[model samples]
Target: MKLLLASSLALATVLGGGASAQTPPTRDPAQIQAGTYAVDPGHTQVGWRVSHMGFSNYAGGFSDVSGTLDLQPKTPATSKLSIKIPVASVTTTSDKLTGELKGDQWLDAGKFPEMTFVSTKVTPEGKDKAKVAGNLTLHGVTKPVTLDVTLVGAGVNPLNKKVTVGFEATGTLKRSEFGVKTYVPLIGDDLHLTIAGAFERQD
Candidate 1:
């Protein structure tokens, strides 16, 4: 098998050489070119957690999340983020529990089929961080909320070879404030939300 061995060795050497020559470009979130980007729904997540009578924390997530982001890297205050979450896409551990959560006693998904957030302002906390203030409409009520946002990074996606940016945001809202007072104090009036979002350049 001398000929086969030589061919394999030569192929390995060529691949190794190519690998050594390619270096991932430096990632600088601040340098992300200004553009309109669509949030990659498949790579994005919307999760929420609530305390259950101080005994346990229940958590769930939503899918079919869609959004668009217009970024102004140079003037972050001008950037905007808008997202719509289908209440019917709620996911939990049990199918039965999911049904209960979507009923009139809770989210009332039948009445309000969707929840949305539109950023009204972006206040820079520091480099790569910001306080995003937005109006959240849910369960037939609207309230102002502020998300503590951190830029995870921005770079070219190796798989698709497209410019991509990611972020993690956390915020808290009072369920009662949104007219969702099913169990109130027992179910915990506050709901914590964590969003992991990815956006790709559109133009």
Candidate 2:
């Protein structure tokens, strides 16, 4: 009887251990579906750098922006993105320079209140890299632009428990093509845009 009881207990313990091992770990839905995400304005940033006077580059940023991203966790290749930036939100350390940038010769924020980008195609380059081809509208003109995007990964925020994903994209645009040719000879025509955005998963 003692031998049988010991054998039964051993079998029960093995079954319990196996059941515990087979149980699946809980995962966040955001990490699983990875569906659509919105840009976390508090954590995302959009910036651009352009030559000022044929000597040095000037950097500025847009403070007000909105965007949405559709991401597929299973197939990231089908992901899409759309963003809009208010031209009036352009800011620089120098007030004079900032005003000049918003004038007719430059961005003409009064006439064109916003600049937008809508993705046409997303081509995967590697494991965490993609080429985002899209139409960029600026200064009342639209042109095709390609952004080289690098996925910076995703994680859960410790404070809010929100799932967040990060990305970095860089592209160059010809200011003249957008009708922003103010100082062609003095300032370089190529404007380099660097975008770093963090998106928070929403219910």
Cα displacement (Å) at residue 157, model 2: 1.3
**Model 2 per-residue lDDT tens digits across residues 136-200:** 99999999999999877776665577867888999999999899888885788898998898888
Runs with alpha carbons beyond 4 Å of true place in candidate 1 = 1-27
| Best-performing candidate as measured by TM-score | 1
Q: Which model scores highest in lDDT?
A: 1
Per-residue lDDT over 95-146 for candidate 1, one digit per residue giving the tens place of the 0 to 100 score: 9999998999999999999999999999987778999999999998988999
Q: Candidate 2, after superposition: displacement of residue 111 in Å?
A: 1.2
Worst 10 residues of 1 by lDDT: 21-30
Q: Which ten-residue region of model 2 has the weakest summed lDDT?
A: 23-32
List TM-scores for all candidates, in order.
0.89, 0.82
Model 2 spans > 4 angstroms off: 1-33
Give each model's whole-structure lDDT. 0.90, 0.84
Model 1 misses residue 51 by how many Å? Answer: 0.5
